[model samples]
Target: MMNIKETIIFAPETFNLAETTRSIEVAKECSHVFHCIFMGYSKKYSYLIEESNFTFIHLEPHLSDKQITQIMNVDQMNGIKHPFTYEHIKERVQNEKRLIKIYQPVSIVIGTTLSMFISSRVCNTPLVYIKPLAYTRPYFEEGYLPSPFTSMNLLAATIKKLFISIALRITYKPKSFTKVAKEENVSLPKYTIDALDADYNLITTTPEISQVYNLPDHYQYIGPVYAKLDVPIPKFFDHLPTDQPIIYFAMGSSGSPNIIVKLLHILSELKVTVVCPMKRMIKSQLHKLSFNENIILCDFLPAHKISKFIDLSIIHGGEGTVQTACLTGKPFLGFGLQQEQRVNINQCVRFGNALSFRKKDFTKARMEQLINHALSTRTIKEKALEIQQVLKDINGPENAAKFLIKHFTVT
Candidate 1:
């Protein structure tokens, strides 16, 4: 067998450290390793990758508005060539090819939306995709689906799933069918198709629970990659009343400002010391609020670590966020928007570890109501502990790394 040259790993700016860590682990096993990130490097991330002996290349051009918009649009379209003509495709291919050449990787692994789009277009190297993990099956099984198109049945419940599938298929033509084939010096298929035809499709999910999908032979479920960052707990947490059960309210990155404010208000009225991590979105607004002694406005804190202290978590159901909460065994009050998030929220609800309120349902009254309900429900707590034990039993990251090494045979 021919020994592989350097393998290039491409990820978006928003790619979490856990995913990055997993990628680096897989890359280290290969002969030589290189990386291309869409955004500039953080010292922490740079140090980690360097420690693994991989050459890091932060491709700044890929982070530009023009590039981001182009990539987002391509994903929104699902890889289909609409709006963008063949001429536009050619232009983009030419532009991206310059960066692709610099890395000179034998195989490329794409883990973020932007990187997925670019690699689909310009690189002829073998491709692998690492998707976020799926929620455990118990979560999906417990959700209530209303019946009939208009009735309160499971059929009604599946409508959201149906529309999401249609929307995704319509917008982003599968990269495999459109870009990958074209770049491989092969004929491009007429429409967007599944990503299975790639050299490998390593989904960040457990095989025991993934829903039915047309996955090809290359597909493998590698379980969740939970990233952790160290953060100091505020002195205030030590002073909070020990008797009162703590409830954490955080709407991960990209959460709506109005919702954050509403949650804060409700928590204050409830007299709960809610910890809200304000990222770039609502950081300024977080300062304006006159927080009661019960509310903690945190700019940056490691949520997984905090989960060990809190009784319940109110979140905007991102996969990574939910997985961390679950691993810690805290029940969730999920508020989700996008299709994937909704699915995760539904899964949490099914497992009896959570209850969800869609973004449309996020009103001050509803927030208060959900918080009250969550606090009152003993079953939710019991279920949370159950799932926590299950997650604890699984060696997620190490198992994922072992799978990649076994399948890819880096040595």
Candidate 2:
């Protein structure tokens, strides 16, 4: 008699690159013991799932391009605006519940899929969330706040926290989701942090750098789960000279194109060679501006593959990008576009592996100054390399898979 494999549904918000890729990487590890099925509403990144040879189920109420853009902005914490409509949420919930009933999987692992939070509960299926440590409750309650750079006194900081607490209550509990959850007899989340809660919240950062006091057992601190994109080496890399220092500018999916353009012009004046992977985001800008012989622009570069050749990385501190920098042993200069990114960057700054600046201070001169410092400084490079040695040994994907197996064993 042949043994049947257990099913595990991996639902990721397909509109974002990091979220989609992270799910794929983790699902790859889980494939040995389970039949992994990828599901999402956006076709924007369906190709990534198909390329990995995973079975993808297209969900209904698909997200439009404009909605995806709106989501990106909301993710960046620009405002409280969202794209979830009553009809859309209703249809999504019904579809999610139907899929859950059909699969009856061990657990549903997700990456920022808001609908899964409700449907998983309705079906009584366990939900595992893959996210950065900053989103966890202990990180906030353990007083990772009153940041070092803040000039505010204790009273001011208290007021700020109070305001944020109120905001969380209002924004985290969206009307559509709350209404849907209540209709399905699911308990509504009281605070914003509750929205991110799952049966097993896999915090994707090393414990050493997470800086959260007294972490709970339910929240596992799996080391960085970064993407190892299967992309070919850029053609320009072959012809490039090895004498000059090479700087990697990776703003990631949410980085501002205007800032990238300005930074490129400044880099043009420097003696270093720049490898920038941003053709898709700045194609029009590229046509408008004259290229510097030292600057090479490509649609994408396998960051993990090229880290050895680069001297420094400049990035908009997305969690995945920061982890990739650490995993590859590259010292970086980070400019965070939002609160979550700021937390990720600040943790690296504390480790002395990177330098960061606020948006107000992110001028051309500051960018140049930091790049020069990171390139010349031996300590930053050494620290990054040290973290690299530690991270490479963790085997985050395998560990995460094991954690799931431990909780939900296949019999």
Which portions of model 1 show Cα errors greater than 4 Å? Answer: 1-6, 13-56, 60-102, 114-122, 133-198, 207-216, 232-235, 360-364, 409-411
Per-residue error at 46 for model 2, in Å?
A: 1.4
Candidate 2 stretches greater than 4 Å from native: 146-172
Give the TM-scores of the predictions, in the order they appear.
0.73, 0.93
lDDT of 2: 0.82
Candidate 1 lDDT over 93-138, as tens digits, reads 4544665676555455655533335445446656666665332222
Candidate number with greatest lDDT: 2
lDDT tens per residue, model 2, 249-365: 888877778878877887887778998998888876766888679988887778888876788888887888998888878789888888788889988888889998766655667
At residue 321, give the lDDT of candidate 1. 74
Model 1: how far is 68 from its true place, Å? 6.3
Clashes of 1: 21
